[model samples]
Target: MHLKIRHRTEYRYETPVRYSIQELRLTPPQVEGQCVDQWKVSTPIKASTSHDVFGNLCSVFAQESAYTSMMIEAEGEVHTQDAYEFIDAPKAVSPYHLLQQTNLTEPSAEMLEFFAASLPQKNTIEEVLKLAKAVQEAILYFPGQTNFATTAAQSFIMKSGVCQDHAHIMLGLCRASGIPARYVSGYFFAEESPNLASHAWIDFCLDIDKGIWISVDITHACLIDARHIRLAIGRDYYSAAPVKGVRSGGGGEALSASISIAKII
Candidate 1:
């Protein structure tokens, strides 16, 4: 399957920002299951800066904002390829590993406990499916209850959160349980809506006899299909934000982002 994606993020500030710096994981890489035929990144302002997260080095841009409006636009053609072996991506493939490698403090006691419990046991693709089912059954997918910043532990305690929270909780559990898992950010084509919003899920490396890596959407309760288009993969949301940046001014600000996607049948 072939897909075209358009994403736009606009920031309308009540006060002008003096300067801002942003990190973007917006560029999609051509990988085993996907091929990037054409892609481009355009920004109203541009600066080149480099930062090291875990082992991956990313080139970011810094900009000065005198205008009240700031926008970043990306357009591309992505071809869905076939799934391949789960090669061990360098710990640098995602910044999520940086947290563990750098020995950053784990956030919640509940998260730590769950991680500990999963470690001793071996997990399989089947187990992941069962876990996804459990999560779907456990959590209520109410739209308004939680936002992107919500954590997995919070969602687990409340049993309520949007897709982002569900994905994060699953990622943490997989990682803690000794499974190599990462967060995936993308768009899902749903029959109920013509326009698709940004979505989140987990990709885990299964230590089967052949050692395959599989992608699962706990929020959707299925393996990724042609309807899914991946933007970025990381440990969690902080690493895979479609558009992320920092600004010097606009201490108090308002921001909005919207994604529109369609299948070319």
Candidate 2:
């Protein structure tokens, strides 16, 4: 399937900003079944592009002049496969490296207990799906209950969060079980609501030797289909956030984001 994606982020500051630099992982990678037909990032200044350690396309831009607001937009067309599994090619980092847990993805004792009790056997695709279903049921999708920095343990305690939290919780569980899993940031074409286009999921390594992985949408408790567009992969949301930056000024900032994904017929 072909998809057209547009993402725009705006930031308004109560005070003038002096200097700022932003790192973007907005560009999608060309994987086995996914192709980036066209992509671009629009910023106030020229941006330099490079690949990150995880092989994600990175775009960086800095603004030096004082400004009250900043706007960044990315638009593109992509082709995706209807297949559920995604076999990622081995990059500079080894899949085993993902076993190490970050603060955001660390599983709590209760989470480990839940995993042990709920899933006592090996993790086949079906078993993983079962785990995903359990996760969705355990954590009700309650928006505004969590933020970007919320950890898997915290959300598990609350029993509610959005997609990001769901992904983090899944990552924590998989990694704790000795399964290699990574966070995926991307766009989901939700027919029900355009506001739910920006999405997050997980890719657990099915076979490390062959770079085999399966993409699962934890919130939906299912494998990713053509409606999913790949963006970036990382150990946690902080590493794969579409937009992250540091600013010298820009106090009391108000931020807004708009994302749209449409079928290209």
Candidate 3:
């Protein structure tokens, strides 16, 4: 499948910002089953690009002038394979390294016990797929119930969240079960609504013996394929957030974002 994606984010402040610096992980990459045909990034200030630990293309932006608003825009085209078996993914990091949990993704005792009851056997690809499906069925996909700071344990207790929360929950459970898992930030082209394209999923090291990886979308209850465009991989949302920054003097921030995905005929 071939598609075009446009993502835009804007921030408004009651008082103009004095200065700010930000790390942006907004560029998608060309990987197994996906080709970045053409892409561009636009920001309010000049930005520099580099690769992170997971080899994700990232950018650094800074502004010294007082500004009441800020915006970032990304537009791109990708050619994706309908299906792929990930046997050739880069294996630079040890699988065990993924088990180093973060605060937001720390599995609670309750979560572990829930996994014990729900996914008694999660050792094989089939079992993992079942776990993904089970998570989707268990959680309610509702907005306003979660925020950017919500943790996986909290989401587990609430049983309601969006894609980011879903990925964090799956990461916590999979890591607790001794599976090497990473968070994936990407774009999902929906067949129905073109308004929402930003997406999140999980990548677990299914077979360390053969360096095999499986992409799971717990929110969608299925493995990701050509429809998913990979942007970044990290331990949690903070690591892969499209924008993370500190401002010297931006009173209170009001943020608005929009995304659009459409098939390119």
Candidate 4:
């Protein structure tokens, strides 16, 4: 399938920023069964492409001068297929590296208990599917129930959150159970139900030595296929966030984002 994606983000500050630097992971990867026909980022400050520790195609940008607001726009056309099973993909790092938890993806006592009782006696692909389904049934997809900084424990306790929270909860439980998993940030195109085109998911590396990473979406309660276009992968949301920036001076920032994804064919 061919898809067109557009994402825009704006940051408004009450006080002008003295200087700002941003690390952006907005570029999608060139993986098996996926091809980037075109891609671009529109910002006042120019950026040069680079890769991060995880091999994500990224960029770094700094404001030329002081400003009260910042805006970033990304547009791209990509073609994807369902053939990417990561069977022969290059191993970037040992999947065990993801066992180390971040604040957002850390498993809480409640989550650990849930996994202990809910996970099947044997860990198999079917067992993983059951776990994913359990997570989906446990958490209601409510947008206002959580925020960007919400932790997996917090979301798991509430039993409600967006895709990001769902993904984190899955990551936390999977890693805690010795199942290697990582966070994925991307765009999902669903023609019938268009909402929150920007999405989050998790990829479980059941066998790192075999170079197999299976994409799973607990939010939608299904395995990801061609409709999902990955932008970046990291230990957690903070690491995979589309934009991370620091300002020497700025106060009371307000943020707004808009995204749209359409199937070209």
Q: For each candidate, how many residue pairs have backbone atoms clashing (under 3 Å)?
A: 4, 0, 0, 0
lDDT score of residue 206 within candidate 1: 69
Model 1 poorest ten-residue lDDT run: 98-107
Estimate, for each residue in 1-265, the C-alpha lDDT of model 1 and write its tens digit. Answer: 7777777878888778888777776666656677778877777766463434422234477665376778887778788754523454453443234224111113367655544433326667777777777677677887777766777777777878877877877776666665767777877756575444678777787653343568888877788776677777666787777677777767667777777665555
For model 2, residues 1-265, the per-residue Cα lDDT tens digits are 8888999999999999999999999998887668889999998889999999998999998899999988999999999887667776545468899888999999899888876755525757887888889899999998899999999999999999999999999988888778888999999997787766999999988888887889899999999987888889999999999999999987899999999888897
Model 4 agreement with the true structure over 61-96: per-residue lDDT tens digits: 888587998899999999998743554236476787
Please, what is the TM-score per model?
Answer: 0.82, 0.96, 0.94, 0.94
- True lDDT of residue 262, candidate 4: 85
Displacement of the residue 219 alpha carbon in candidate 4, Å: 0.6
Tell me the tens digit of each residue's lDDT in model 3 across 39-145: 99999979999887777788998899999999899998999876434553564556678887899899788888877765625557677778787778778988789
* Candidates arranged by TM-score, highest first: 2, 3, 4, 1
Model 2: residue 12 alpha-carbon error in angstroms: 0.6
lDDT of every model, 2 decimals: 0.67, 0.88, 0.84, 0.84
TM-score of candidate 4 versus the correct structure, residues matched by position? 0.94
For candidate 1, the lDDT comes to 0.67
**Where in model 1 is the C-alpha error above 4 Å?**
47-59, 81-85, 89-120, 194-196, 208-212
- Which of the two, 2 or 3, has more TM-score? 2
